[model samples]
Every structure is written in C-alpha cells, then in structure tokens.
Target: MAAPDKAQQLEEAAKAAEHAAQTAEAAAANASGNAEAATAAAEHARMIADQLAVIASASPISDFVFLLTIFMLAIFVGYYVVWSVTPALHTPLMAVTNAISSVVIVGALIALGADLSQSANSFAPKLFGFLAVALASVNIFGGFLVTQRMLAMYKKKER
Candidate 1:
C-alpha cells in the first residue's frame, strides 16, 4: 500500500526466503545421507548374494549336474570325432558311424530298458544287441585287423 510499508514487507519476504532455503538445504543433506546409507546396504546385499552364489555353485548338486552335462557333451563330441576323423571308413563312413551310434544307443537303451525276452529286470537283450552289432562291425570293416597290422608294423620297426 504505502512505499515504506511495501519495503518492510519485501524485507520480511527475503528473510522468509532465506529460512526456506536453509530448510531445503537441511532436507537435501538428510536425503543425501539416506541415499548413501541405502547404497551401502545395497552393496552389502550384493556381497551376500555373490557369496551365496559361490557356495551354491560349488555345492554337490550343482557340481554333479555340471559334471554330468560335461560328460554328455564329451560323448557327443566323441561321436562327432569318430564320424569325421577316420579316413579308412571311406565311402559309407556316415552309414557305418550311424550303425555304430545305433548300437551304442541300443546298449544305453538296454541299460534303461524294461527287460524283454529275459528276466523282467534284465538288460540282456540290449547288451546282446549292441555286442552283436559291434562284433559284426569289426568283421565287416576290419578295423581291428587294420589297427593290429599298424601295431605290428610299429613293433617290427621298433625291434
């Protein structure tokens, strides 16, 4: 209303604004402190989680599952090696390899099979089937003979 009264009102308003700024600064400091505490707590929780993961990963069940997976993978790799590595298997290597794979699979099946034509609990059929196939494969392919000849040549040279 009056100029002097308006000046007094403006001075009071500035003091109130300074007070508000101080309160806001305090609140901001408290918030930053709480955020730091929260960050520390989260870091602690993450450390616990990492320790638990290490323990769980090294536990017996996890180890067993990991080893079993590796073994299966190794068997698959062996199958791949056998299929591709043997030069003597020339024309029908794939077919022969398939036959070999089938025989081995039959043995595995026999190992897991509900026995048939023998003891109800027996794995004889699967075992016998795989054995017969293996023997026949050796006879037909002469792989053993070739290996033996190579061994004999090596021995002769060594002698």
Candidate 2:
C-alpha cells in the first residue's frame, strides 16, 4: 500500500509540472503577440510622421503664412491669459509655464537635430530651430526668475 501511494504522488506531481509548463508557454506566446503588435503600431506612426514631414516641406506659401498667423494668435492669447491670473495663482502658473517651455526646448532641439545629413532645404528648419531654442531658453529662465521672486514674497521676514 505504501509503495502504491508514493507512485501515485509522483504521477500527480509530474502532471502538475506539465500543466505549469503549458501555462508558461501560453503566457510567452501572448507576450510575443503583444510585442509584435506594438512594433507594428510604432512603425505605422513613424510612417505617418514621415508623410507629415514631406507634406510640410511641400506645402504652399499660404500654409506657412497661416501657421505664422496662428503662432502670433497664440502669443496674444498667452499674454492675456498670463496677465489675467491672480497673484495667488501666479507661482503655479509659472511652474506650468516652465514645464511647457521645457517641452518647447526639446522640440526645438529635435528640430535642430533632424535630417542633419539632408543638404537640401535644411537651412530653413535649422534657422527656425535656432530661433525656437533662443526663445524657449529666455522663456524658461525668465519664468524661473519670476517664480523665485513670487516664492520669496511668501517667506516670513527674518528678524
């Protein structure tokens, strides 16, 4: 009876390990499928981005003028919004502004670095990138200074 019980236990253990192995394989397959789908999505996004770049380069002068107009409008809107914020909210606003300025800096850097090897039509983007970098730098530094000043106002005066 003892011998028969030990054999049964060994068979049960082997079956459990087999089931575990199958479950692991299924999980690995699922992960592989997810990875492949992600790769395909990334590739599609890259293709779309490439198409947009080409379109931007080939776009008409009116398109450029329209974009410039939008940029100008944005500046006006930002000015009004910033000026309207109350003193109590100014520091938080400045922090948000700094975060946005950081994003602008990153975009400017990407614009500067993009297609460095393309000799044709590269100068225009590079010039714009340089301007963007300069403007973002000023915005970021200025925001920091203003935030510092605002924060200072909150501190208790030392005896």
Candidate 3:
C-alpha cells in the first residue's frame, strides 16, 4: 500500500484538533449557562424565604394594642402608689380613690370576658382579651393594697 501523503496526515490532524476544541467550547458554554440559571433560581428561592419569614414574624395590630394597654395599667398603678404615699391627701379622697380603682377593675373584667365571647363580628373575639383584662385586674388590686398601706401609715402618723 502506498504511504499516505504527509500533507494529508497534517490536514487530518488539524481538522481533528479543531473539532475537539469546538466540542469543548460548546460543552463549557452549556455548563456555564446551567450554572448561571441555577444560581439565579437559588437566589430567587432565598428571597422568597426571607419575605415569608418577615410575614410570619409580624405581629397583628390588635396584639400591639393589647400590649400597649398592659403597659398603661402598670403606669397607672405606679402613679396611684405615688399619690397614696403623700400625707397631705385627705381621707375622703383616699377612700373614694381606692373604691374607684376597684370598681374600674371590675369593669375591665366584665369588658374582657365580654370581648372573649364576642369578637368584632364573630361569636368569639379572642381569648387573649380575657387574659389581658384579668392581668389588668391584678394590677388594680395590687395598687389598691399599696394605697391602703400608705393610708394606714398616714393615719398612724396623725395619731
């Protein structure tokens, strides 16, 4: 058999190399495109998860209102104790103040229990309302005791 020409061998070798390089380039492009798409999809999923977390962590407006109310009760109790400690205040004022404080507590309990049974439009408002009211009652009762003690101390001083 005649020896293959050197020129033909060289040409064949060049063609094979070109074909391999082209295939490699195409494969690399495909891999890079898939990676880019995967990265984008992952970022999108992470963003959605963050949004859901924010929504889950957000508190309702009613809950905020209830929390504010509890804070107010604490302040009220503090104010009452301060007032009861002063000796210049009269007996009638002390007695009326204590009675009024107790009455308001009963009113709060009634409002709270009512709220539990009746929501804005539904049959049940929320059970938390009752708990809030009960806690408020405790604050008022505690304030009254403090006030009574202060009054007793003042009366002993007067004698």
Rank by TM-score, highest first: 2, 1, 3
**Residue lDDT tens for model 3, 1-159:** 235687788889999999999988876676566556656655655565566546556845465665565456546554554444323434444566656667766765665556343345544333445565666667667767776776787674555
* Candidate 1: C-alpha RMSD after superposition: 30.4
Q: Single out the weakest 10-residue window by summed lDDT for candidate 3.
A: 81-90
Steric collisions counted per model: 0, 0, 1
Better of 1 and 2 by TM-score: 2
Off by over 4 Å in 3: 1-4, 59-159
C-alpha positional error of residue 89 in candidate 3 after TM-score superposition, expressed in Å: 87
Candidate 3's TM-score: 0.35
- Model 1, 1-159: lDDT tens digits are 699999999999999999999988876676566556656655655565566557668776576665565566556554554444334333344455546655665665555554465577466666676676666566545744555555565464544
lDDT of 3 at 95: 60
Question: After best superposition, candidate 1 residue 131: deviation in angstroms?
Answer: 54
lDDT, model 1, position 91: 34
